[model samples]
Target: MLVYHLYSGGKDSSLAAWILTRLGYDVRLVTVSFGILDNWRFAREAAENLGFEHRVLYMPREILERAADMAIEDGHPSNAIQFIHEKALEALASLPEVERISDGTRRDDRVPLLDLPKARSLEDRFNVAYIRPLLGIGYRTIKELTERLFVVEIRESEQLEKADYEVELRHLLRERGIDPLTIFPKSHYQSRVLGWRGQL
Candidate 1:
């Protein structure tokens, strides 16, 4: 079966794709662009390094705006990020060739998590399986696996500036003369892959 892996060029998602490949599934890497400044180039490069076909999906800015507004109203971006993630999953699930959908979400992931209710609904409505290979793995394990498999670059999320859903929403807010710090909490982290270093 074909698995559409939601890739972000980070350790988690990249590791997810790696795990699926090792399982002998036809895995395709997909990264969604929500009109934010991001390091999507790294995602494409990572796909190349891993020898996987990659595709970029463009999400409307308005959808991101709705999520941002929700976050602003609730005083936290977690719910907003989750909303964006569900929408992303919904879009991926609509693909006829996609029998299963996967992401790099770990057991410790808070925002962008596929909650039980949403997961069930997606499965029931789309007749597809939402798989998270890294769900039961912790942060240390994810890092170890990634380091063992690929050449990755670790940096602060704000520095990369273009790879996250919240980054786009934050940019929108800044453009409107609003401070993102007023909404999002401090010290968020994201990952990037520089190249591949053979397979584990």
Candidate 2:
């Protein structure tokens, strides 16, 4: 079966898509964007390094604006990020050709994840199977697996380059003359997948 894994050019999404391939599913990487910045290219290059077919899908720009406002209001990104993520998942599932979809969300993710009710709602509404390959895995195992399978450049969240909502949110904050640090944490480390183990 063909499955589209929401990709962000990071180890998590890349690993999720790669696992789908190993499980005998024809997997394609899909990167979602709001066109706020030319960030999707990072994901495209990462996909190329993984040897997976990749594509980009534009999401509603207003969704990003709303999420950014919410993040600024809340002084943290959790709820806002989760809201954007769920919406993005819905947008992907609503596509007429999408039957199965997947993402890199893990059991340990605190932000940008869908709960059972939302997941079920999506499945019921779109008739799409939502696959989460890393949902059961913890942080340590995920880190070990990513290290074993990918060549990644790790940097603090604000300094790293990866194609995901955080980048655009930060850009939005900056564009409005607000430092992203006011809305996003300055302490987390993020990975930018350089390539597969030997593909670099």
Quote each prediction's TM-score: 0.90, 0.96
Candidate 2 lDDT over 37-130, as tens digits, reads: 9899999999988889999989888998898889888988888789888888888899999999999999988877888998899899999999
List candidate 2 stretches off by more than 4 Å: none
Please report how far candidate 2 places residue 172 from its true position, in Å: 0.7
Q: Lowest summed-lDDT stretch of 10 residues in model 2?
A: 191-200
Clashing pairs in 1: 37-162, 38-162
RMSD after CA superposition, every candidate: 2.1, 1.1
Clashing residue pairs in candidate 2 are none
Name the 10 consecutive residues with the lowest summed lDDT in model 1. Answer: 157-166
Top-lDDT candidate index: 2
How many clashes would you count in candidate 1? Answer: 2
Candidate 1's C-alpha runs over 4 A off are 36-39, 198-200
